[model samples]
Every structure is written in structure tokens, then in C-alpha cells.
Target: MASIDLAIAGLAIGAIAALSGIGLLVTYRTNGVLNLAQGGIATLIAYVYREMAVVWGLPVWLSAVLALAVLSPGIGVLLERLVFRPLARRRASAAESLVASLGVMVLTLGMCAGIWGLGAQTDTPAVFPNKSVGIGGHHVGVDTISTLIVILVACVSLGLLQSRTKFGRQMRAVVDDRQLAELSSVPADRVAAAGWAFGTTLAGFTGILLAPRVSLSPYSLSLVVLETFAVVVAARLVSLPAAVFAGLAIGILQSELTQFTVNGSLADIYRTLGSNLFVVVLLVLLLAIPNLRELGDAGSAGSFSSRGGQEDTGTVAERSKDLVWRVAGFVMLLAPMLFAPSDLRHAFMVPALALIFLSIVIVTGYSGQVSLGVAGYAGLGALFSLKLASGGMVGIPHLPGLLAILVGAILVAPIGLVTGYPAIRRRGLTLALVTFAVGAVVSRFVFEQPSLAGNLTVNPLYIGGWELGDKSFYVIELLGLGLGMLAVRNLHRGRLGRALLAVRDNTGGAAAVGVDVRNLKLLAFTMSSVVAGLGGALLAYSASSFSSDTFQPIQSLLWFTAVVVFGADSAVGAIVGAAFIVAIDVMAPSGSSTLAVGILALALGWLPGGLASAVRGVIRYVAEQLADQFVAPASPIRGISALAPAALPAGPGAVAPSSVGTKPAVASARASGSTAGVAAADRVAADRGLALTPFGRTLLGLVGGGGTARPTPAPARANGAGPGAAGDIDRHATVGAGDFGSRNHVEGGHR
Candidate 1:
């Protein structure tokens, strides 16, 4: 009977996970977005529902309807229309859309915190009445029964909707080819909107159901939704039944694992696993899954967004200028040592964090791989450094900080290789999600476990008898930072850079060029992790303590956003961004920096290339201005000089009598050079001002006047139109109200 009760309890939790998984899958299948905002959306709706039912004293049903039916779906439509639609219109890569989704997540969480605060909301009223029922000779909670029914209804309804209705057919058609569907007169926008609505509604339902099982804190709630990724990954983002079954299986298995008992340290390990079974399920499933069923075009370059910087194809002389700029930037970093002791201590965080961001730049910016698990690697480095310094190894005694950092980095490299192997075939959002899952699991199972990381401490490096002070320590950090920057610069130059660029630009092309992409990816992951480990060691030493919060999964998200905001590919930008973040936190109230960064990341679509890249663009433009000022202008009259000596002589000799019909001609000739130049400039200015040309004006008039201007026929052809056009017009009809079939002609005509 006890076993049956536990099984029921586990199944109830699984049922909720099944709900969240189905929501994620449906959104992905229909819109081709993995919806990283699922947790945020869930958290928002749960809070709203709580506010309505408990705080505002609304009826349970009314609150549920308002929260689930209106607020949740509205959020979906809002995100689709605002954040996602622009990216989709631009055909932004899956990776960009993934980051945007993360932005939405970060934005919503910030809003929740600003509005509701981060404290646990124990008063979150459950809509389902607290009642029990007799089920096969055992008592069952009403909430559990309700959750099961909701899950079943959603699954069956979605399955039927997808397999049956015209809506489903249209959705699949749109998913296959959005432009093609539009050409066929299918309502692509409406279908996408419907998908968002349904997906978000399911999210709300799951959130409400799960709220009763745990205290409602932002972090805990978000983590719960993330752990459910195990089910979604198990489904491969395709099978509805599979996701549900996987969820239930994990829940039940987790419950069953609690029955076992072990002695000594093994017991502590069991307890950790038992409490964090869902996280374990997530990590295991992500690593075990061979490949994800990613949506839309698989070959689409969705992961690494091009920052639109001009490719540097300049000579060695020009390249030397770039080297000078880099050197100046390094000098600027070193200038911080002049600050007071307190300020210098704060500056120490910059190099440490900069090294961490540089790792992201290498893995994400250079190679177009998205990793959200760098925090996990960093945390491990700190732990390993502590272990080495504590003389905890079987044979080794306590080591100095420098030796410990080296050993920690070497120890951490294999962890990266292990994770990177799974990442060989994965890219974009799938890779990001998988890495995030790994980070979350590590946080819960290792970092948070008292038996593992609770006693971590930092040991300062001593040189002879001189212990490094804050100023000296900051200098040492800068040296490590410099080494990291040098390594990154090497990766970004020469043959290695070309190989990485080739891989980033096109994997197939890179392979065709004889690049070993798999090995390159693994190599990048290994090196990046090593650098990140070194950074993490410095971060721990700077703090003089180790806390699990330092490497929370969400911190990885913030760090990634900060890197992207500062221009992901720029090492100097990474350093600047780290300083910016640290400065923001020091100067502003807590969480303000997150809010500011979140806002900036949300607006990254319009800015393009991020704040760092934008600054670089400005600097380059200024330098170009100065260079142009130093160059002499060419003689404007030189082209005519070669042919015009005789002409000038003839004109001087013939200020001569104008012919009878030559009055207008003489005036026009007199208008040559200065007058003509002025007229021509006026015309050019007008064209620029109006943004139009003669041909453009004519086309605009034709289009505005509602006339379908027929194409002029070739002189050889009797009729202007091609054969079979009249008969097959409907068959070859294009999407949109305009003649999409003739888009090239329209575009060329406009140009």
C-alpha cells in the first residue's frame, strides 16, 4: 500500500512534467523555436494566478481562466509578435532565436522579481480543492487526479488537432516552408499565432499544477521547469506519448530510489541523488540522446549570428595598426592598478570574469557553438583548486596557488572533452539547452552537496616569503588574463582562424576543405574549458570563499548575454564587458545590472553586433576621418586636362560669334563644369532625399495606381507572356497579396 502511494505521488509529479514537455514540443514542432522561455512563462503565469486567487480574492475558476486562458496565451502571442517575429522575418538563425528566447526568459524573470520579489510565496493558492479520493483501495489527492486528467486531455487533444484538422495541416505546411505556404494562400501568421497560444496555455497549466508540490520561489520554480527538460529530450521533440511516459517513469524511479539505504559517505551521496533525481534524469537524458529532432532547416546557420563587421582584408601595414590598438587596450586594463586599495580589489574581478567570457567567445563566437555549462566548469575549477591546496589528494601535499591553478585546469580539461563529444553533432539552441541542463545538474548534485563542495576554501599564492597583496594579486590576475588573451588571439589568427571561420561559416564547406570539424570542435571545447577553469580559480581566490550560487545555471545565462552584448568575438570587448558588469553592480543597487543587461539583450536585434562591436565601429569611423584629413585630394580637372589644351585655345580664340541656332547651345556649354556640377549635385541630393529614382517613381505610381504592369515582350516573341501562364496561374500562385512569383523583377526594378 505504501509502495502504491509513493508510485501515485511520483506519477503525479511526472504528469506535470509531461504537461511542460508537451508544451515545449508543440511550440518547437509548429514554430521551430525550442522556447527557452518556457520556465519564465510558467513562472509568470503561476505568479499571476496566485495574485488573482489569493491576493486579489478572485474566484478559483475565474482566476484560472484569466491566468491560463488570457494572460498565458497573450504572453505567447506577445513574444511571437515582438521578440520572435522580427528574427523570423530576418530569417535569423536558430541560435539567434534561441538567445532571444533566453532574453525573454531573463526579461520575464527580472519583471517577476521587480514585481513580486524573490521570496518564497507559500500562499500560492491551489485551484484544485484539497480533497482525497478512494482509488483502487488507496487514497489519492484531488490535485494529482486533476493533473492526470489535464495531461491526458492535452495530449489527446493536441494529437487529434495535429493529425486531423485543417489548422494542423496548415501548421505543418507552414512549418515545412513558411514562404511557400504563404504563396499557396495559407495563413502562416495565424497558424504560428495559434501554436504560441496553445503552447503557452499548457505552460500555465503545468505551472499551476506543480506549484502545490513545492514552495514558490523564483529560482526553485524555474529550476523545476528546467529539470523537466529530461522528458522533452527523451521525446526527441517529436513523440507526445513518449514525453509523457518518460516523465512518469522518471518520477516513479526517483521515488523508488529513496527506498535504498547506504552507510557512511555513500549515504550522503544517495541523499543528494534522491533529492535531486529530476536533475540527474535531465543530465543523463541529455548526454544519452544521440541527436535532437531540431525544427526547420537543419543546415541553417542559426547558432552563430554574424556581427556584420567588415572583413579585414587590409595589408600588413594596416594590420599593424590593429596590433597597436590591441596593445593600447591592454595598457588601459593595466592602468586600473593606480586605483585605491579598495577599488583595486574590486578590479580583480574584471580579469577573472574576462577570462571566463573569453572562453565563451572561443566556444560560441569563434566556432559557432553555444555552451551554457561554462559555469559548471568554472565551479569545478574552484573545487579542484581547493582540493589541491588542502592536500586532499592521496600522494600530493598542499600546493601553492599557481601550481594548484595549473593542476585544476589540467584536471578540468577532460570534463570539457566529455561534454564536447555529445556536442559534436549538436548546435544552436539544442546544444545550449543540453549544456544548461548539465550546469543545473552540477549545481544541485555537486556544488550544493555539503559532502562535496561545502567546505571549499581558497589559498593565496606566496612567492618566497612575500604574500601578494590586493595590488600585486591584481597584477598577477592581469598576467593570467594576458596569457588567456594571447591564446585567444592565436586562435583568431592564421590557419587556425581560417579553419574555425570555415567551420563557423559552413560545416559542409569546412569538411570539403579537408577540415577535421569534429576534432576542431573538441579541441575548442577542451581549450576553452581550460581557460575557464583558470578564470574560476582566480574568481575563488579573489572571493576567498566558495558558494554554489557563484555558478548557478542562471548565472551562465547572464554571462552569455553579457558576452554577446559586448560583441562575442572580441577579446578586448569581453574584458570591457566584465569591467562594465562589475562597475554596474558596484555603483547600482543589486539586480539593477541584470535588468539593464536584460533590456539591452532584448534590444540586440535592432543594434546588431552588440555594444562592443558598435563602439569599435565608431572608433574605426573616427580613425578613417583622421586618415582622410591627412590625404591630399586629387586634381578634379585632370581628366579633361589631357584632351582640353586645344579646346581651351579654340574657346579663347572664339569667344567668337554664336550661330543663329546656337544661343541655347552657348548657354548650355557655358553651364559646363561648375553649373553642371551644381545641377548634378542637386539631382543627386534630391534622389538621396526622396530615396527614389526615375524608374522607382514610375514603379511606385504603377503600384499605387493599382495597375499590374505587364512585362515588355521580347521582340522575337509575338505575345509578352510565357506559354501556359494563363491556364496555370492558380497552380503556380505565390504567397502574399503581391506577385511573389515576380519578386526578383520587382526587387530589380526598385534597385
Candidate 2:
């Protein structure tokens, strides 16, 4: 009876989860974009409903209708038209779309925080009454029953629409290939807009229904909705029924497990697991699921990398320009040391954050793997360093602060192997989801645990009998960064660099050419983790404390985006991104840096290779222009006369020009015994943009006395006109001239 009652009590949350899952699935199926912003949208709508009903004293029904119907769908339509439509038209990579969705998420969360403040709201309006009814030997709240009924109605309606409607088939076509569907005269944009609108409406409903059950807050409510992603993942992002079933099952299972109490050291662990069952399910499913059948092409991970500025060899002028840029960058980095002591301390994060960003460059930039859990590795490093320094961790000796950092980073390297093993099989979104789940799990279980990390202490770094001050510590950080840069440079050069590039460009092709793709991926992960761990340790030492919030899962997303926006493959870009973030935060409001990054990320379609690549292109162009100014131009060649040959040079190295309309000199060489010479002459002619006509070739052969070859007649044009008639035609021919004209002629004639 107790279990039955608990299950009944769980139905409200189960219904909300179902709604979220269905929303996610529908958006993905229709738009072919995994909407990471769904949770943010839900949180925003919930906040709006709370403001209208609870704060402004509006009617509950009116507030619900306004928030769920008008506001939610309006936001959806606006996003489809303004944010995602351009990306779709450009055929952007999956990674780009994912980043854009993340931008939307960040922007929405920032809006909610900026407007409503970060304070929690306890009183939220409920659409259904709190009354209860007795049924089947149990008392269930009216809200629970209402939620279940509403979900059922929504699901049934959605199922029928998807299965039996013309719009649904049109949506399917658009999802499969937007260009093809548009060519086939389908309204792809409208179908996509409708899908987003419907999906966001569901999100609003879920948020409103669930708000009354939990304290309404920007981050907490949004995180709760994010957990519902487990339901969609369990359904393979395809089937709505499967999503509904998974949501209900997990909710019921979670409620039922709360009935049992365990008294032991592992009791807290069990309770936490029971509470966060969805996270556990997510991690397991992502690890166990071998393949996901995504709509459209499964995009390559390497597409996220920049395309320009990868040249290994350059001229002296280019190399000198690079040197000047490096010097200027170093000057900028070191200038912070001249600030006030307090301000200098703030600048400590620059190098540490740059090192963390460089770790992303190692995995995503060099090796083409998407890792969304770098914060997990970083948080673990900080925890380990603190524990080791304080003598709290078992089986590890207490050590001085500097030594602890080294040992902690070395210990954390193996965790990258754990993440890398999954990356061996997964890629793109699946890999991203898996890494995010890992970070979320680590953050919840390890960092948030009072027994594990609550009392941990982080000490200032010291070197044998020397207590390091702020300036000394900053210098040490710079040294560590130099070492990381050295390692990256080595990785980007020689045979190893080429192999990693080959793997990144094309995995199957790399393997076909004998590259060990698996081992290389593992190595990249391990090295990246080491650098991230070192950076995390430095971060803790710089602040002289350990705070779990410093390495939250959301921070990882920001770091990844910042690295990509600056230039994923550019080390200098990573450093500049860190400086920019730190500088922006210091100069602006709390959430302003997030807003700035989000705006830039949303505009990534316009900047294909990121800020670093764009700068490099400008510099290279300038260098070429400057170099060209120093070189003298060549004298123009004298034209040959029609009736007479050109004068020959005085030396054997010079050759006489054939008369106009004669065969090219190279043709005479080919007719003679010097075919290789003809090949060489052809190369020189190509460099000079010289075209060899058949008549010219025959005349050259006769002039050189190599042969008396007859001239070959030109083929008739596609309009059945002779070569002479084709020649008489205007340069801008109509479509009737067919092959005699360019593509514009055909298009113009059709018009």
C-alpha cells in the first residue's frame, strides 16, 4: 500500500518528465537539431508564469495561457527564424548547430538571471487545484491526476498528428534533407518553425506544472528539466512512446526506492543514487548504447576545427610577422604584473584558464574529439590536490603544496583514459552527451559530497623552504603554461602531428593508410587531461581555497565555446580568449561575459574560421602585399607579326617565335624526338597562361620542319552550327546557343 501510494505521488513528476522528453524528441526529429536550450526555455516560461500569476496577481488560467501559448511559441518561432534558419541554409556542421543551441541556452539563462535576480521563489501558481480524491485504495492529489490526464491528451494528439498528417510528412522530408525538400517544393521553413513552436509549448507546460512542486529558481529548475534528457536518450531520440514509458518507469522506480532505508557507510551513496536515478540511467545508457540512428548525415567531428593558418612552412616575411605577433602577445600577458597587487591577483586566472582552454585544443582541435566533461577532470584534480596536501586521502602521503599539484595531476591522467575509451566508439552529439553526463555525475557525487570535499583545504604553492608570493606564483604559472605550449608544439609537428591530422581529416582513410586511430585518440585524451589537471591545481593554489562551484559543468560548456570562438587550433587564440574573458568580467556586470560569448557564438556562421584565423589571414595578406612592393615587374613580351617570324635572341638559350597562326613551338618538339622537352615547354606555357591551339600546333610543326601536318577541323557547336558560325556569335550567347555559352546564358534564357 505504501509503495502504491508513493508511485501515485510520483505521477506528477513522471508526467512533467514525459512532457519534457516529448518536447526534446519532437524538436530533434523535426529540426534535426538537439535543442540544448529546451531547459532554458522551460525555466524562462516558468519564471514568466510566476511573475504574472503570483507577483502581478493575474488569473492562473490567463497567466498559463499567455505563457504557454503566446510567449513560448513566439520565442520558438523567433529562434527558428533568427538563430537556426541561417545555420540550416548554410548547411553548417552538427557541432556548429550544437554550439548555437548552447548559445541560446546561455543567453536565456542570463536573461532570466538578469531580470528576476538569482533569488529563489517558493510560491508559484499551479494550473490545477491541490484537492485530492480517493481511488483504488489510495489518495491521489488532483494535480497529479490532472498532470497525467494532460500528458495523455497531448501524447495522443501528437501521435495522431505525426502519423496521419501531411504536415508531418513534410516535416520528415525537411528533416531528411532541407535542400532536397525545398527543391521538391515543400515548405521546409514553415514546417521547421511549427515544430519549434510546438516543442516550446510543451516545454512551457512542463515548467508551469512542475514549478509548484519545487522552488522556482533559474538554475535549479533548469537543471531539473535537463535531467529529463535521460528519458529522451533512453528512447534513442526517435520514439515518443519510448520516451514516455522511460520517463514514467524511472519516476516510479525512483519513488519506490525511497521506501527502503539503509544504515551503513554507503547509506548516503545509496540515497544520492536513488535521488539522482535519472543521471545514473543517462550515464549507463550512453555508455551501453553502441549506435544512435540520427536523421540526416552524421557530421564529422573535425568540421569544428578552423580551416586556415595551418601552414608548416612559410616565407621569411611571414615568419618574421609571426615572431612580431608572438612578442606583442607576450608583452600583453606580462603587462598585468604591473597592476596593483589586488588587481594582479585577479589576473592569476588568465594563465590558469588559458591552460584549461588549451586542453580543449588538445582533444577537439588536434585530434577531432568533442569532450564536454573537461570541468570534471579539472574538479577532480583540484579535489585530489587538496586532499593530498591535507593528508585526508587514503593511500596517498601528505605532501607539500607544489608536489601535491604534480602528483594530483599525474593521478588524474587515468580518468582521461576512462573518457577516451567511450570516445573511441562515440562521436559528435553522442560523445558530447556522454562527456556532459560524466561531468554532471562527477559534480553531483564527488564535488557536492560533504564527506568527500566539504572540509578540504587548498594551500598556497611552495618550493623547498621558499614561500611563494603572488608574483612568484604567477611566474610559476607562466612557466607551466610555457611547458604546455612546448608540448603542444611538439604534438603539432613531425610524424605524430601528421598522423593526428590524418586521423582528424578522415578516420577511415587514416586507418587504411596504417595509422593507429584508437591509440592516438587515447594519447590525446591522456595528454589533454594532464594539462587540464595542472591548470586546475594552479587555479586552486591561486585562490588559496577549494570551491566546487568554480568547476561546475556549465563552466565546461563556456570554456569549450570560448576556445572554439577564439580558434580551437590556435594556442595563442586560447590565451587571448582567457584574457578576454577575465578582462570582460572585470569590466562588466556579473553575467555580461556570458552574454558576450553567447552573442559571438550565435554569430559564428559569419566567422567561419574564428577570430584567430581571421587575424592570421589579415596579417598574411599584409605581409604578401609588403613583399610584393620590393619586387620589380617584368617587361611585356612583343607581339609576333602575321607574315614574319620574331627576331631570335643572340644565344642558343633563346628560341625564335613562330609566325602568327602557326603551331606552338612545343608541338614541334613533341613531333620531333624531344617529347620530354615538349612536356617541359607545356609546363612553362601553363605558368605563362599561354593557350595552345590545334592550328598553331600544325603551323609550328611545319615551321620547325618536323612535319607537314594537316589542320584538324573544329567540332560543330551544340546548335549544329559550324565553328565559323559559332565564332560569329556574340560573347553573351543565349540558351539556344547551348554549349557555346556559359551557365548564366542557360539560366537567363530560362528566365
Q: TM-scores of the models, in the given order?
A: 0.80, 0.82
Report the lDDT tens digits of candidate 2 across residue range 524-561.
Answer: 99989988988898888877788887887777877888
Quality of model 1 by C-alpha lDDT: 0.71
Any runs in candidate 1 off by more than 4 Å, and if so which? 53-61, 299-340, 616-751
Quick one: best TM-score, which candidate? 2
Q: Which lDDT tens digits does candidate 1 get at residues 1-751? A: 3778778878878888888998998888888888877887898889889998888999988999999888988988988887777776766667677778777777777767767877888887777888889989888888878888888888899888988998889889988888788899999887888888889999888888777678876667877887788888888888999999999988888877777778998787788787778778777776777667777755333234333522222234325435534665576578778888888777778899999999998898788788888899888888888888888655778788788887987788999898888778777656777788888877877888888887776767787878888888888888889889998988877557746755765566455435688998998898889889889888988888888988888788888888887777777778877888788877865566666777878776765657755665566677778778996753332212212222321233332111101233332343354677544433332222111111111211112111212222112111222432211111111111122222322211121
Model 2 regions more than 4 Å off = 308-329, 620-751
Q: Native-vs-model 2 lDDT?
A: 0.74
Highest-lDDT candidate: 2
Model 2, residue 427: what's the lDDT?
A: 77
Clashes of each: 6, 6
Error of 1 at 271 (Å): 2.5
Question: Positional deviation of 128 in candidate 2, in angstroms?
Answer: 3.0
